[model samples]
Target chain A: MKITFAYWGNYTIAFISLFQKLGINVIPPEKTNQQSIIEGAKISPEMYCFPLKANIGNYLTAIKKGADTVFMVTSLSGSCRLRYYGIIQDKVLSEAGYKVNFVILNQNFIDIYQKLKKISGASFWQIVKAVYFFFKKLHLIEKLEKKAQYLRPREKIKGQTDQILRETFPQLEKVRNLRELTKLKREIKKKISEIEIDSKKNVPRIGIIGEIFTVTDGAINFGIEEKLGKQDIEVHREMDVTYHLKKIICPWKDWQIQKKINPYLKSTVGGHGRDAIFEMLNYTKNNFDGIIHLLPFGCMPEVVIRPILEKIHQETGIPFLSLSLDEQVAEAGINTRLEAFVDVVKNHYNNKNH
Target chain B: MKCYLGIDVGSVSTNLVLIDKENNVLFSLYIRTEGDPISAIKKGLKLLKEKIPENAEVVGVGTTGSARQLAGVITGADLIKNEITAHARGVAHFIPDVKTIIEIGGQDSKIIILENGVVVDFGLNLLCAAGTGSFLDAQSFRLKIPIQEFGKLALSSKQPTIISSRCTVFAESDMIHKQQIGHKTEDIVAGLCQGLARNFLANIAKGKNIKPPIVFEGGVSENLGMRKAFEEALKEKVIIPKYNTVMGAFGAALLVKEMSPQKSKFFGFGVIDKDIKCTSFQCKGCPNQCEVIEARIDGKVMARWGDRCGKWSNLNMNNI
Candidate 1:
């Protein structure tokens, strides 16, 4: 293992494949596990957001497996801890006596593959091709998840939709170009369309808006979307790698969203904090039955937005379930809260329809 | 008479309830779980067996609480539900117009807001038990008073001391400082109740509508001091059901009845005599390393769970 990137669901493999195209041997991160979380927590400051600790866990594990370089995700925006995580993590890693090369890339990799160019010293055309491949593959993964979310709640069999995700995500990792990606997309849509579904099932729609990592990484949030799907709830998440990429490609989009959030939030508090308010209001306007806000415990930006989320809930009257999670939370406890949220959402949905 | 049975296997206590066709609770028991829900459930079922008429049949059985899944498998429950849903239904069963429910259990607490007999919102104490029954239990032991009489003693305070209840440890230390500084024990106890009520309303019930017909249930309802503190803080009356301690089981029974299963799957009182064993393993098939739990009765596996992937949980454990 020469280097490893912060694992982001299917996108983890996409990152690895992108770098592998550049002749960098990066092991796909071992899916975030208890061992990694524990390993990460042992060295991390107690109150650091879960994603940071998890990254530490992944890097330490990768180092143990002979990964000599750490390709870390960071930001230049100083509004959140994300901008400084690379520096802090670099210090911590060096202090731990692990001599490793650090390649810090902003999360909006599409607009800034220049960092990769600088590191790999690759030709501009070569870097552009690798970035395009990574972006295309990421978009396809997002599409698969969207289709699965829709079908999951209505599938006649509980696990059929899941079976598709479980089997197809790996097949997606093998996709090399736009042609193969298109073919896989069509086949996935065909498979999903073929899944036996009762379209008339009374499913409540929920919008999930939160910190990117906790929302995107299923392991950290305990696959909350799947849990909701099992209970006949349609989950629509607006925060993902693609969403971030689009926002980065178009800078003015933030200004538009910031305008909507101005009354609720004085300014962009950084990260998804502002995006969450925008998403909640969006969900309310769309008549979503509820919204679930996921944030790592004590995450400053997300935590600050919590009260604003509550205010929005009060004004909009759409039910809201806010879950601040870390390793301290048990899956059983999360399941119970989700069950309760669904029950409430279902009741609210039914009453409105009648 | 045919009756529905509800078994609630919680962290601190196990409750069992028997309700007739008309929703009349015929038998109810609240016993200490004592860290062994299996044995506590068996004890409740044995006691129920002894009390019921010989010709009476258990038409349905339901389970709820933290250990609901475990209890459901052991008792062959027709419906297994979360405690929040069960408690809401239980309260609405008595007070159909119930707008709010404040339930404080042994290890956790919850605030449920209901509108028109349907739950609209709810919250559970996420991190740990801060303001709950366990804290009060520990306090009563330190005071050398029976837990049963703690609430009554608290009600006797003339000038309740001011205390903090944000964290249990902090609250305990605050209570001792008050006690050493010439505060009466009764006053300190009353302050603890008030602090708990304020914490509950502020944290778990934060920003929710506090409407009337609010019902308080669970083991903590027996603590009269808690009710007073709630009533004082809300400036509205708080109602407790007749079988408050067993409300979780009562609601579960009512829900199973509503499901109207064609046949009951209850193991009956015979489960009391069965030897049930629970075992767990860390699965290495995938990177997740799910800790799968299996329950067996007399060497025959009945059910398995706790796996994120369905591989282990979906396996026919009976065959294994």
Candidate 2:
């Protein structure tokens, strides 16, 4: 079996599972780790964002594990550096002397279908089944993540909620249909509802917003949601696979966000610059305690939108903390910032109620 | 007599401060951390053991700074806080109406904005630690002037030269170039101070409503030259608080005092006598291959940390 795979993130299960159903010998990419990062960083541009570096790391590891072909998803002209991610990685991999087949999914529907047809030798009907299953699994993954987010701080035992998520994720890969998902959903919901919780606990709620990759991928942002949840802060974020799918299926949602963001962001600078403002407004309107903006070191959209975020913070008087992540980010620094941010939000929440 | 102890373990220095129940700073000691926070903390405790009255019982303990976690573990701290909160808390204790806090420490600098005695927002040095205390320490070493005198000399120069404030490398290189061209030492020093002040404003203080009366507290605030440069730039006078150098420790004391735990978790002066050691190694159990660090006291593990999986961190301790 010639192994084929893509890099990992919130979309890993969806991407790998879809390929698996097509009879491709797919080895799931390993979790982002130190060895892979050091290898990837050595061969990549010094200033590449953490996501790109992480992808390169995973690709190198995939090749080491005897992967013969790889496919990756990319955006086109998001006014962000993401447009060039696949091209740059392909060049870097070729230079490193890898002979594996490479594929880039730039959202050209017919081209993607044709590529799949060529690679898998599957009929049009088969590819359709695989892709439809992909959307369903993506929705399931996001729903599971959202449930875990809600239950983490409220769980009876410290690691109980995360343990549920840990158990359910792999089981999801084997699920065949909406009926199975519904059965799994009921079983999980029963377990969650049965878990003891202090419904009266008044934990400060915080919204996580900013760059999609960093927000979606826990390893890169150092498991911020987990850390915040552990601190007795209820964490909420709207930038998941389903929300992004909505942006793609109904770009009117983005245009609506862009319209609201125009006073702050004159035009789309790519990769969720407009969505960031719209989300910030959403959190504020909902009377959330605080908002944390996670910006990858030199990300164009994030850097450009920083001042606007600050202005909103000033006018709104909501405690906002901007955390920038890079390869050199130390866990201790993020820990310190989060601890202080919790204090700020709790204080703000208390003041509002009084 | 009873007291609350606040210990701040930082990269360059460790500060221990004692405060009364009334929240008045009673005794404060600032000493070089010297790369080993354990010894520095013990030494601080030893000196403190000698000075404080025999009847002075430590009823509460707080820890803050970069090594706050380690210090909290060693001291049995009832309260642990970050530098920003500690600095703000300490400043608000003295000047209740202060609106902004500008703190520059050994390795980091931050601008904290407060409204009504509570910190509302803050900004830490991003991308670069260009003009922090360590940056000043380096310039002073290269210039062959005492750090204490670096600021004094800068205060003497009327016309400060212009130097790039983009980063520490360029700023120091510019200073050396200016010196070789026969620029006065005072002028170059003054120029460096101005550059740092400018950098802090444009970077850390950017978009932060740096309202006065701004309280500047940290090791760097002791530099009179930097103070003058800030005043000239903001066109508003900056006040250096009474306990400028040890404000973080001072604030920790204030926080613990305010929290007022029934009984102190402090290990007492006897902790200085224990044999403490730390060792780290890579765990090959999984692909993450996390580097796990173990802190020990006489071959019994006090703490095991630095692992992504709970397998290591959640393990039961056995004598080793």
Candidate 3:
């Protein structure tokens, strides 16, 4: 069966490796763009979150590209709209007259393995090996991304880190085994370190926190991380595919984070709102120069957390900027706001020194 | 006499201000952009030449506003700063104890919160024109009243009607409905001003701690009705500075005076008569087809910008 799934940063690489190892044909969705967003928004409910629309667009594009089976991950326990995305997408696709198989994975790891075996006729040991390779590749990409973040603000030549990171992705895709992966990792590290950087530049540190989809999706947010890096601001974003996977695997870690946010947010408000609050507090304690909270427009959980964030800002005297994104947001408007925010943060940082 | 020149090129208006060594305004001009910033800036410079004393020399130059980059390139400004910093600086110079600044310009509005003479936080309206000066300008035309006299009429209203300010389009329809229901012109006008005031408080100043000694400046600050509405809504008096219309330019001049750049980049008023042209083309290097802008003087490219990758920008770095 031809299988397709939405792309989420570098996690698509790990998924491709896993399915290939399992001997199942995989068709990855095209990179997100204006076309995908338009197609997705056309079919999605008016009030649905941006991620849902973008994912729908991805699925539709994959279907047109000859994929008959669509795979998606959903949460069974949360009250968030993410839990309903799979079923809603299924209904929408069926109504659109597409003959496709919909495979929805939940928290049950055993169930996922059984389904994979049924589809690919893979043995338990093969499945375990495939999973091992997937995790290894995912972790490696995560580490590389962290390194790129640090290098981006300091690189003497603008866009040098991004260019190197883009080039390394293909090399990563060609690796066949653990030895090759390790060698490739070492080579990439050496190349990235060779790039000239100003070690003495004192740049303001900014922590980005918010809904996972809006924060991590470059196309949706208009390349915020790159924009900030170009402005010589160090950006720290903790939300990523690997981090999300780790939270799912070790649910207790999320509970520990939730504990820190208990005083502000008593109960789970669904989605990533709770996590955003926890991360904001952590960044504040670390003495970050500023914080940017990004979320999709009409996001219920994020809207609920806006007031709480204001309280936090008032109490701590830490500057915070909230950006609500949708299809309608203009790129120039975002750029202007970011420029002004950087100026304020820089002035505040300089004033503190004297 | 030595002076520092500052230019604020906004969407609707372009302001030029020259300040002396003692921070006193030497000459200032406010001209309508009329969709051509280059000509507006040139006209202002021509006027400044006639107004300033023959002994005055421009020692430093600064540019601020939405089109600050373009203005800086044309004027060879020593410093280019955003409107938030420029406005904050201008307000602080007038009111040393000012803690909040409410600036509503042609297309955008902003709220700047300060503590101990340094900007602590600020917010800009996101692609919304509900509470901006342009919205009020449009309504004045529809109401068949001169824009200047619109605010004076509002002050005569005994009881203003309640109008929603959630969106400009919605507010316009609401105003039409009020007119159809036979609401008094003065009451409707007052309602519109109050509606804009509400929109500013709910959107731009949302969650912001606005304290006393707040200064209101920008093109919209000229509306007496808006000032009174803001005062009534917040239960606090809003101070309108003397140079409210040109505060951004005034602030930019003040900043350049403080900076005291060793070599002033002031191209001089003579550069305004030069033949400068700007054109843009889509770069096809990647999927993110950035529209790169190029500025030329006498057909020789002088500046290149708007490319996110800096590919084109780096090419003209020497010229800039």
TM-score of each: 0.97, 0.96, 0.92
Model 1: per-residue Cα lDDT over B36-139, one tens digit each? 99999989999999999777899899999999999999999999999989989998988999999999999999998888888888888866467788988888
User: What order do candidates take by DockQ, descending?
Assistant: 1, 2, 3
Query: Candidates' lDDT values, in order?
Result: 0.86, 0.84, 0.87
Q: Of models 1 and 3, which has the larger DockQ? A: 1
Q: What CAPRI class is candidate 1?
A: high
Q: How many Å off is the CA of A133 in candidate 1?
A: 1.2
TM-score rank, highest first? 1, 2, 3
Which 10-residue window in model 1 chain B sums to the lowest lDDT?
B122-131
Give the distance in Å from residue B28's predicted Cα in candidate 3 to where it truly belongs. 1.8
Candidate 3 displacement at residue B186 in angstroms? 1.2
RMSD of each predicted structure:
1.8, 2.1, 2.7
Task: Specify the highest-DockQ model's number.
Answer: 1
Candidate 1 residue lDDT tens string, A108-218: 656356777766778888887887888778777787788888988999988889888888888887777778878998898888878999988768899999898899888
State, as a TM-score between 0 and 1, how close model 3 is to the true structure. 0.92
For residue A260, model 3's alpha carbon misses the true position, in angstroms, by 2.0
- Candidate 3: lDDT of B258? 96
What residue runs in model 1 are displaced by over 4 Å at the alpha carbon?
A: A107-112, A175-190
